[model samples]
Target chain A: MKSSIQRVKAIVFDTFGTVVDWRGSIIRDLSAWGECEGVKADWAALADKWRGRYEPEKDRVRTGEIAWTNLDELHAHALDQVLAELDLEALSVDHRRHINRVWHRLEGWPDAVEGLTRIKRRYVIGPLSNGNVALLVNMAKHAGLPWDNVFSCELFRHYKPHPETYLGVCRLMYLDPAEVMMCAAHNGDLAAARAAGLKTAFIPRPTEHGPGQKTDLEPTQDWDVVANDVIELAERVGA
Target chain B: MKSSIQRVKAIVFDTFGTVVDWRGSIIRDLSAWGECEGVKADWAALADKWRGRYEPEKDRVRTGEIAWTNLDELHAHALDQVLAELDLEALSVDHRRHINRVWHRLEGWPDAVEGLTRIKRRYVIGPLSNGNVALLVNMAKHAGLPWDNVFSCELFRHYKPHPETYLGVCRLMYLDPAEVMMCAAHNGDLAAARAAGLKTAFIPRPTEHGPGQKTDLEPTQDWDVVANDVIELAERVGA
Candidate 1:
């Protein structure tokens, strides 16, 4: 296999499940808020169900089923749908808005911050997520992820797994795709980036969807580098 | 005068002279490169002349006289014009491209890194410059500016001193204009930002255009905050 590691100058990440523990953070946040509001359901189930709506809503924008919308707005829309689905429509608008911002308050993986800090010293490191710019920026501040920059679907007006989002970052950085590495916890995200001529690194987040998660537990394809976590990924990159 | 300092949640900066020393850095880079290539000219004069074309070229884009183009392309166009004007056409194309990237390798002002690091503890900080996204991102990496996010004219598709660029950042951050402060070394940049309803801070860059720089050496308007440098600006902002 060709070692493209030496050629990589920038590493852009998929933020949600890669850098931040969105599933656990959201479940804890909503469960606490739900208890206070006297609303009860299988909170973990709701968390999983809520996340299940994420990509489909974004797909609405990607496929032009809806107008171009940001991830926060999409999350809000998806939240409403899930609330109605669970028969919990009594949640107030202000509460709903606050809950929608849970994505911004996500806790980073234990190694995310220090690993990113180390790798940042050697390469330009930043989020290349489907999240909006404000969401990613706020999360970086909240989680202490020292990103050199923030790239978002809002910047490209295209959702990830789409070629535009992947290629647009390279265009913005004035770099060839091979010189940029797309690092993610999801095998699918890495596969898409690799197909787009970019270098790829996969780090499995087996519990990203909770302990029973069946997919993305291992690199499904031959990725450029597969590490245990960001810390190991940083070591692999010689940072 | 109203004290809007307490209301500010984010601070966006005008980068060129405010944060990075473009003139000195470019002059030093090109002078060393020129010596190596056996090229000869008054490089300082060329640097000043090249900077003189900066706004007018962006103005062409702003006015639709030229199609929307990135700062790198505009810089290249300006460099070609200056090279022709100075009769220094013997420089190779590769070397000229390297010279154009000098903007990316600019050194930060003496107080820029520490002051920004201090202020960032209390606020969201980033460049709101007319430079493209990659340029600002590269400069932050080059100078250790510790920006929480990177904003650019390329994101808004509008140049600074334009309402769109100022208002665009507020839109991305989901912030009211009053809650975001525009900080710059240039009063005109502050003036433009203020007219758009944002708070403004001016920190004079006396030697931005070299020691004898005559303009923007002091605040000409009743800016919301006036400080000697970013360190003082951070103090005024309660960081």
Candidate 2:
């Protein structure tokens, strides 16, 4: 809600569907892998359901309803349940690991690399994601995403929406929260970042959940900046 | 001594003086800043002396000979002594901070960026420096060094050649020691890394200490790969 543009020095992103097209990328990747491995299932549905578990599972740990767990752990747990529900037979640990790494091979949105390159010329740009450090690192390498650093929930042992998740990045970068901006396609993410005293930029990812995506179809709250895409966001922020 | 290159998946560099010419960069930066600020001193000598303090000071913290200190604190300690020796009068905290950040604006060796980019295409290339995370991150940005992550001694709260420094990187990256190679211009650093079971590559910076530099002019110990420069190192490593 505030336009204190001069205060921001770094911008952290929500990675899953904002910087990268997780839904479409995962569907294509997993489908190809499934075809190669001769394993068949409704991977699109499974990918959506897997993402759906991300928040609730993370909330369980964050709210102390369950023990603290990393995104990798939560993903594994969700993967087990979904695989069982899909009537997939027992798989080896190696196979599970390979499948879990599908998250690491995500393709960036078309504008992601170019916009981030422009933004990097001006400010520090990195992902503040629920993903682990290794996952984010591999994804950056795979997708050619030019990140100044990879700030992950793995660093703080806490997931996003937790104030520590945002504040931990500021601490690591040695910057004040006010000097760091959180840009996400999710309103809840920006809301959390705003409440944590960090500036917020929202870019709607209407198709984040595919055609029937209902929530986060539009900006739900007033943010410091709202852009049509990463390119526009960079231009608007003078990056 | 071991030529077992099969296990090394990532190669992390020691940033200051190893990957980048810290002495040259700092001396030049500080000398220019001194001229601008109407201050005078033996900037080159001071830069060299400050670099010299790095190991002995870290050894003090690492071996419990002195209290544990982060790089920023150690840098401040060295700064105070160097300032007195240079006979600089009282300066404001802002001025001191600006001077301290000479470390963040280091220039990489001629082959640093191109070699690193090549290596990065084949391996997870990052900095495992004694520099604090923010300092390393900023240095990378300023120098256009392509690093997948900035793994600093600050993360482990222990400076090299501490085993924890090497082990912590592997732990964070989810890789075994054999899966990570420690690449450095200094033999002492490679010695410690090899002792800790990590693979080693030596790319000598004979002039790191400026004219008449003696030590680390040649690989004192057998390193897995000995290259004259980073580009040669990249080629030797099949990057």
Candidate 3:
């Protein structure tokens, strides 16, 4: 472990792909729902396309093209567009509403709960994701993630890669930047946290974007700690 | 149970006296420390004096006499005045700092943990206290309070009786005011919550201020529900 890990008092995680398997969970959940409803459509391609829209939505908020919209609203609006693109307009408004909430029902990766419970024993653990407060709170309850608190971009009114999201967690928790570790699966997220002066830990989820995923399969820079999954990340950090 | 109880999807609590016995905890902890350090002082009197300073400190912030200061800072500032008044200047700065965190180390009431856990299984449960985020988080860890999330005056930048503090919890959780119930031992807090459009539950802690406690001995208004303790409150609300 890096010497900086010894100073860490809290660990904030990226939720979407790091703590929870958004891609696989959404694909599996929506596919099962569609089959049960007799609403045939290409669930996998729709899932990927919908996930692709998340960045653009965040960019609009970051660049000031749009006001601070919570992730739940962004996800709902994006789901509407993708449903139309996939010619699934036959799904009712209520159906679309429930479908968009698949993000809230996303399941944790196999090691997520065990790892978080362990790290939580030693440090303040929470989700510092771009997801809104309600979405992250619901997700934690659904997935049994033992977060000490849930920190969301909605609370800071700034998305990931923004300095406020990284620093806000430290400010609210009364810890210095170096005393808070930003643990995530995405290289971009960790790079931003590093730039914001927080310790960084990389946990690569190679199948996060599905087996064909080509990016973020390894640590792109010298993060303070790098592990194959959250469980190993906990052990490596001496949690 | 009243029909309003059925509408409550979330329950937020007051921390100091409602869930935890601050008076008892601080008096015992500080007296033990005083004995170990070969110091002599009225621990009970000091505890009462420090708590009495809390309202004036909050009044200063709420009236714009000072900027938005968090509870930890307010507590530290109050401790300075009380220490001088009681002539306890022999303690080191480091000792004072650790001593001020007794608020974070407060133990929950006998039924607090079990009651909160029961309510949590049925509805979202959290602390919507004037305490700062770090204080409440540390207190929960110390007392084993299983909150789904923690809300604080620091998050809203407003203290209790301010409509913002009462309604902020609902807004953050994406619920209507009626969907959230404010549970407290203090009648003033529940009155403010009711005025702010939230459902209210009163669980009078008659012994919170020690056996001589007089105020808030009974429900002052027709609150949505009233009970003797949190365990009864949980049952009254049909949790």
Q: Estimate each model's TM-score.
A: 0.97, 0.95, 0.96
Please say which candidate is ahead in TM-score: 2 or 3: 3
Residue-level lDDT of model 2, residues A121-177, one tens digit each, is: 999989999998888999999999999888888878888788999998888888999
lDDT at B143, model 1: 87
Question: Please, what are the lDDT tens digits per residue for candidate 1 over residues B1-239?
Answer: 24666788999999999998899888888889879987788989888989999989999998999888999999999999999899988788997998889889888999999999999999999999999988889989888899999889899888889899999999999999999999999988998999999999999889999977789887898888999999999888889
Candidates, DockQ: 0.89, 0.73, 0.73
Best candidate (score: DockQ): 1
Each candidate's iRMS in angstroms?
0.7, 1.0, 0.8
Candidate 2 residue A206 Cα shift, in angstroms, is 0.8
lDDT of each: 0.90, 0.87, 0.91
What's the lDDT of the predicted structure labeled candidate 1? Answer: 0.90
Q: Put down candidate 2 lDDT per residue, B1-239, tens digits, no spaces.
A: 23488778899998887889988898899889889998778988788778778777788787898776778778888887877776774876888888888888999999999999999999998999999878988999999999998888877888888899999888877899999999998888899999999999998888889999888888998789899889998888888
- As for candidate 1, its interface RMSD to one decimal place is 0.7
Q: Give the poorly placed runs of model 1, Cα more than 4 Å off.
A: A32-41
Candidate 3, residue A111: Cα displacement in angstroms equals 1.0
Chain A TM-scores in order: 0.95, 0.95, 0.98
Listed per candidate, the RMSD to the true structure in angstroms reads 1.7, 2.1, 1.6
